[model samples]
Target: MKLYRHALSGHSHRAHLFLSLIGQPFELVDVDLAARAHKQPEFLKLNPFGQVPVLVDGDTVITDSNAILVYLSKKHGKTDWLPETPREAANVQRWLSVAAGDIAFGPAAARLVTVFAAPIDAEAAIARAHVVLKRMDDTLADSAWIAGSQPTIADVALYSYTARAPEGFVDLQDYAHVRAWLARIEALPGFVEFQRTPVGLTA
Candidate 1:
């Protein structure tokens, strides 16, 4: 398997992290985002959407960060990371939605502003980050993981951006449960650190 990605992208890190955690040996193909390599014709053949974190497994190609997670979990038959039962699966999917929706526009967008000079509303992004963090904090207070007692793809989906929320000026100080959850994730075997940039609050 080969993952074509940019180092600074949290979306890319999501795929990379899961691959390592699953002990899957894969090559990391760094996409030169600064030179717009992802938008070029060759890379477009892999993913016409011109996105980072495109995974190529033999003849199979997976795009989108969340989709990559699902594909990997299903392909490797990692049922624990992606439950088989209806209710459990739905619960996992729910947080995956949050990771794509709120987490995307909230903390992720905010970080994009600082990390990539993206033209986004930092103030609104920061405010949205807080709202989702509060939701995650409240949910995590009762459950050990975001989806349930055990960690799932739902946890992986939310981990990257939430852990780096502080870099977006979205402080984690008040989200104690969320903080504890981050520590738990870091303690997992084969866990890899997301490359941190000294920006926003971290700067």
Candidate 2:
């Protein structure tokens, strides 16, 4: 399997984290997002959306970070990562929705705007981000993971952006529960740290 990813993208980091946790061996091909490599004809053939974190398994190509998570979990994982029960599957789906919908539009997009200098409505973005963060805090108040008790693809899907929320100026200090959950996820075996863009890349 080949994973086309940008080192600094949170969405790519999620896929990398899951592959690490599952002990899957794969090749990493760096996508130079700054140079617009993702938009090139060769890369566009792999993912028409021109996004990083496209997983190529033989002839199969999967795009969208959450969709990639589902594919990896089902293809490689033997435990509860994908889950077998209906309720467990629904729970996983719910958190994945939060990760894609709220987390992506809120913290993820806000970080892209501030860090990458993308144009965004700063006030509205920050307000939406805070609301999503509060919801995450409440959901994690008495639980260790996002979906239910165990760490699933849902947690992996949401972990990267939420862990780095403060980089976008969304402080985690106010959310003790979320901080605890972050710690739990970080403590997992085979965990790899998300890499921030170097000075040159950000410049």
Candidate 3:
């Protein structure tokens, strides 16, 4: 297996984290996003979207971070990282949707502006981050994991961006439950952390 990923990308981290947690053996092929390598023709063949975190396992090539997570969790992870029951699977899917939607436009987008200097609405992203974070915190007030009692792909999917939300100037001071959840994830065995970049308020 080969994972083409950029160090700074939370999307990339999502796949990498899961693979590590599952104790999967694979090679990391760093994509030079600084040189716009992902946009090049060769890299585009793996992922036409020109994104990092493309996975190549034998004849199977998977694109999209969330899709890759689902693939690894279902295939290699058996029913561990993912669940077998219909209701549990649906619960994980709900968080996956939030990870793609609110988490993408919110904390992830805000961090892109601060860390990469991408031109985007920082205020809007920060506001969205707060809304999502509060909801996550409230949901977690009763639940141990986002999906259920056990950590699933849904927890892995949402962990990266939400943990680093503070780097985007989205202060997480009030989100105590969310902070605790992040700590619980870090404490898990086989956990691999996303690379931290000091930016925004942290600077």
Candidate 3 ranges with C-alpha deviation above 4 Å = none
Residue 181's lDDT within candidate 1 is 97
TM-score leader: 1
| RMSD per model, one decimal | 0.6, 2.6, 0.8
State TM-scores per candidate: 0.99, 0.94, 0.98
Model 2 CA deviation exceeding 4 Å by range? 197-203
Ranking by lDDT, best first? Answer: 1, 3, 2
lDDT of the structure predicted as candidate 2: 0.85
Clashing pairs in 3: none
Candidate that would win on lDDT: 1
lDDT of each: 0.95, 0.85, 0.92
Ordering by TM-score: 1, 3, 2
* Candidate closer to the true structure by TM-score (higher is better), 2 or 3: 3
CA error at residue 154 for candidate 3, angstroms: 0.4
For candidate 1, which ten residues in a row score worst on lDDT?
A: 161-170
